[model samples]
Target: MPASQYADMFCVEVWPENAPAWNLFEALQTQWRAGSGGVIGLDYGVLAEELRVREIPPADHEQLRADVRVMEAAALQEIYAETEK
Candidate 1:
């Protein structure tokens, strides 16, 4: 896909332990959809529902989480550096 396809993309990671965070997520989703006239692309519900039916093998779960953590950290660091510039 072209890079522009993801220009407005946003990602969130929520573990079972942080289930309450979904309330905030839902609120953001509502606000974004409303402000953008429902043109913000795919909603989190799409991914959430996909995750509901998909099962990750126990062996790979930790590694997947760790990889996501690393990527998220890097992205945040990049953003911080950019802001400091």
Candidate 2:
């Protein structure tokens, strides 16, 4: 299956090296669970914040953001195709 199809099925955690970032995702997931709606999207803003808090290098942050954008675009395209089917 495509990454977009399972994007919301599970959250990715780049652990050990980025444990704090993973923890941030866990916290956000907890807050999301309290709401009525299921997790259908990601909060990149919060992720960026967490990365900053974790003192991730700027170069690494840019690379991570770029990777995420690629995945998000692919996921959106997949969803659009599904809707058109």
Best by lDDT: 2
Give every collision pair in model 1. none
Give per-model TM-scores: 0.40, 0.45
**Model 2 lDDT, residue 5, Cα:** 80
| Lowest summed lDDT window (length 10), candidate 2 | 30-39
Model 1 ranges off by over 4 Å: 1-52
lDDT of 1: 0.45
Q: Model 2: residues >4 Å from true position, as ranges? A: 1-42
- For candidate 2, the per-residue lDDT at 22 reads 47
TM-score of candidate 2 to 2 decimals = 0.45
Per residue, candidate 2 scores C-alpha lDDT tens digits across 50-85 of 678878787777766655555555655775578679
